[model samples]
Target: MKEEKMRFPLSPKANPQAVITGEHYRFTVLTPKLIRLEYAENGMFEDRATQTVLNRAFPVPAFRKLENDVSLEIITEAFHLHYLKKGPFSPNALFIEVKSNFTNYKNRGRRLADLANEF
Candidate 1:
């Protein structure tokens, strides 16, 4: 089978004042199918483990800022990503939700505990 990928390059948009201030959140829309979320301390580097978990080779998505500084959204033909900034001292304050138009009947409505119990 062939691997599917995004058709366009990723675009990143964030509040000009947003930074790694040990409380700020960074959102990068890597592709229509993938996004990278990063949090840093004291305006420094992001955690290596976090980077590892979110890293993937995919085309980037287009980004757009919301009406307010604390929120933004990214979208493609199949997926939509929304992000919200929480606070400064809370580098992990970034909240994200990804919605996809596609559906998988087999995995639908599976709870976290149910998946954990499977193993």
Candidate 2:
């Protein structure tokens, strides 16, 4: 049997409601299954890094607009993502919340070992 490889396009159309563009970064909702986050040091045309985070692995996500367009809710099969835009107090903060059926437990043994492996 041949193993199929999944491919995600680097550029995709942004959802008008959830899209935000800044001088150094561009954030957009590409599709119900994925969201694209891009950053450029100089500008979008130079020295850029792009990454697409999966929102729904199987079923498509449902997007919900929150109060006064301050927050957005992305409901997926695997997880729920809550995105909060920067506010008056936090002018440069981007907050994200991931709700899933998993607990994040820090491994003390792996902490030092992982740091050493980096070198």
Q: Candidate 1 at residue 43, lDDT?
A: 45
lDDT per residue (tens digit) for residues 43-78 in model 1: 454433342443333343444445345544555554
lDDT of each: 0.42, 0.41
Q: Tens-digit lDDT track for model 2 on 15-85? A: 35655455455545545545555555654532133353323222323555333334434454433444343
In model 1, which regions exceed 4 Å deviation? 1-23, 46-60, 88-97, 101-119
TM-score of each: 0.40, 0.35
In model 1, what lDDT does residue 114 have?
41
Model 1: lDDT to the true structure: 0.42
- Range of the 10 consecutive residues with the lowest summed lDDT in candidate 1: 13-22
Off by over 4 Å in 2: 1-11, 45-96, 106-119
- How far residue 43's Cα lies from its native spot in candidate 2, in Å, is 3.1
Best lDDT among the predictions, by candidate number: 1
